[model samples]
Target: MSRYLLVVPPLAGHVNPSLGLGQALVRAGHEVAWCGPELHLRPLLGAGATVFPTGSRLFRPQSDHGLAAVRSVWDRFIVPYARFSLPAVDKAIAEFRPDALVVDQHCPAGAIAAHRLGLPWATLACSTMDLGDPLAVLPRVHEWVLGRVRHIWDKAGMPADEYFDLRFSPHLVLATTSRELVGRDFPEHFRLVGPLLAERPDQPGFPAGWLRPDRRRVLVSTGTLADDVSARFLRAAVAALAPLGDRLQAVFVAPPAELPDLPEHLLAQARVPMLDLLPHLDLVVSHGGLNTVCESLAHGVPLVVAPIRHDQPINANQVEHAGAGLRIGFARAGAADIRAAVTTVLGDPGFRVAAARVAESFARAGGTGAAVAALARLTESPVTTGPSRSTS
Candidate 1:
């Protein structure tokens, strides 16, 4: 059996997909080792892969300050990613001498190490990368903006153009989304492998009165990490749906301490897995996070997306244009807009049908299994030469 080294970012969304891929690799009789923060140990070990913890300050964000949070991700998150991960991954390669390296697309250090060491490597992109094409689900402008930011970051120290040139140029880019989402013709090296989600085990039972027919079950969430905007969106959704009275029941996934008073019929705060709660949901109100959007689609539930930062606006637009959901502009959407969007989706079955179709397409793309197979193939046919480097 060949050995494989998987390098993942510390965030739950990034680590979660890598965990699924690691589990599938272990099941296929490959020895896998994961490097990240200590918190990831339990989950990685549980997947039957060996774990190595690295120092990553990005794992902890100071949520009290919004701009600080964003800055911290760029500086603390991306900087250390290059500094610590390069040496750690190189050491792992020298010691364990893995047949190949499987890394998250964001971790360019791993790609660099794989290149320098002359080991085969593949990038598992969790989000859309094609930014130029109008038909692409992820807008080109967002990519341009992010690229400029990265360039500024590089000029400060690393030279962003060279980084993208060396790290992203010729690596086999394995995306978790299908071609339907990106209209551009992908290079031969880039392959669409569908969504790489962790398989759900049977979850704990829902609380009593969690689902009430008297009110529409609206799930309000912004995922785990970036939850500040979630509160604002939730407040709007509650205000919009409150008029429905017993017709709308809003379930917000958040710590109870952070929740404010809302309509008694609305479930303001609760701790629940999104996958578990989505199946019973009538409408999902969210910040257009990838996991949340994908999970909603998986359950055939329509969305009312109020996006704030990052890829959220792109995801929201995808859902809206596809007829599976509606996008309420982050700066503009108020309670009335949130309510109207939710009502429009709930009132029409066509939205749910479109969501179901995308979910079906996702299933046919082979989910995590295809990712596992791709990794396995690397073990069988290792790419000895380093990927071509380009300046762009």
Candidate 2:
């Protein structure tokens, strides 16, 4: 039996996939643990899980949309957080002394620690931000991102001559998506293991009575991280879906206080068991989060996506390219625009067919099992796959 450590961020979308992979590792008779903020990790992961707490700090929320959001992710969160968390991650490495690590792409400190100790590690790519080279179109933006990564590496005293991209591990990169949706070829090291659909904690109870047999069901969620920026979108979604309540029931994942005067057919909640709810949904109106989008497609449910920022636009484009859904402008889309997009998706049978096709591919891609197999391979060969500075 091998001991493996999972390094993840506090975000639900990032951590959820790791939880599933960790469970699969445990089921295979291997020991598993986590390194991240304990306050968030303890609740997301149950009490049974072993977590090395790195504490927490208040970084500014990613409230900006479009290009600004990308800048905030690197300047405000990724770079600073890596610096703040590096010491703790280094300490965890010393204490855990695991055979290998599965590090989230957003948490570069984990990769740095792995490189520092010459540990075998695999990159867990929960989003498409790094895979397709989205920034390649803008040479300056792409260079800026690389500059930030290099700055972090230099600060950590890593070898300047051997600079490997922190977003990818030389050993392996487990992407939580499929080729059908990616609409592009993957690198040799990338393994498209599809969505890691596993049991999650703090699953809010859903009122089964809310569903009506006569009406088709729809779920409207703009994702968890962008509550600040999503209020306007959620309000528009409520308006768009309100008129269609007689034909369909809509569930909005938002606080009741944010949206007022909801019609009888609409329900608003802060959180819901997305995994459990997806199977029952006929259509999903989302912010194009990779987890929600992949899960919806896995259930053969069509979508109307409004991309706000970061990898969301890329995911939205993929959905459109795959003929699985339509993308609307997040900031410019009003009630009518949202309604029109929703109507188009619901009216066209082709969307459902495309969604089902993606779902079939996801099933064959081997979700958690494939990821485990890849990690297992890395453990068997513990040689340093990436260049690292040696103390000796």
Candidate 3:
């Protein structure tokens, strides 16, 4: 059986999309293992996922939002992260020595290491692929991101002087988002198989007894990275939804400290089993995270998005453009605007229709099956079909 090594970054949302595909590969009789951040990622990858530590630093961003965060990401997170994991990834190649590398676009060290070893590798993007395209709409950000990748590739003896879009593989680009959520006109090279809504084994369950059988249930969360601005957003959500009173109930997944102050109308938690909860939720007030957005749509739950940073603004715009939700500014979203948006999504049948439409697309996109087929085709071809070989 051919072994496929997955190179992923530390991000939970990013690694999540790979889970279903890894399971699919395993079921197909191909060996699958992980080479990602150190120890803590083990449990998250689930049982049977043989994971090797990439010797990556535990990078927690000191700045959560704004221009400072952009600078922090470049200087502190991405560049330094690439440096920290470089040797570990190369070591993984020498030790584990898989047939092909299935790499998350965020993990550049793996790509460079694969290039240095002359091994075929496919870029598995669990995030927005458009951000890393050579013809990126945000050219400056593209150049900056490539500059970081070039630094590591140059060190690894690959010619990194030229520009390369590491996000898409020449062999196969397996993306979770389809045209419905991300838009049409994606590069022909990309295989958009819709979102991988891979359910985790352990779900954080809530007190189902607390729900009033008659009320519309809504969920509020910023997904995995909520520590940055949970307080501000949670408060606004409570204020916004308070008027619903006996008519609506909002469940908030937040840190322990942020729970007590929640306006009398909401239930709060450190975390929740989102997949378990989505079916009951009529509306989701989120930070426009790609995973949450897709999951909400998958369950036919409409949304009210407050885009905080990074690709969130883009995803929120998609929700708005799709007529599935309303968008609000994270910091500037007052109680009034939040309430208005929440009411619009919850009260309107059109929003639910749009969300169900997105759900239909996700179903037809074939999730893990589509992704594995693409990988299997690339693996069987035995050609050097990946970024460095194609770009070079």
Per-candidate TM-scores read 0.82, 0.97, 0.91
List of clashing residue pairs for candidate 3: 176-194
lDDT of candidate 1 over 301-363, digit per residue (tens): 888887765556677888887788998876568888877788889899999898887778778
Ranking by TM-score: 2, 3, 1
lDDT of 3 by residue, 258-316 (tens): 65765555888887888888888899999887878888898989999998766677788
How big is the RMSD of model 2?
A: 1.5
**Candidate 3 weakest lDDT stretch, 10 residues:** 126-135
Which is the leading candidate under lDDT? 2
Pairs that collide in candidate 2 are: none
Candidate 1 or 3, higher lDDT?
A: 3
Candidate 3 stretches greater than 4 Å from native: 60-68, 129-138, 160-163, 226-228, 261-265, 385-392
TM-score of model number 3: 0.91
Candidate 1 Cα errors over 4 Å, as ranges: 40-49, 58-76, 129-171, 200-205, 213-215, 225-230, 384-392
- lDDT order, best first, reads 2, 3, 1
Q: lDDT for model 2, on a 0 to 1 scale?
A: 0.88
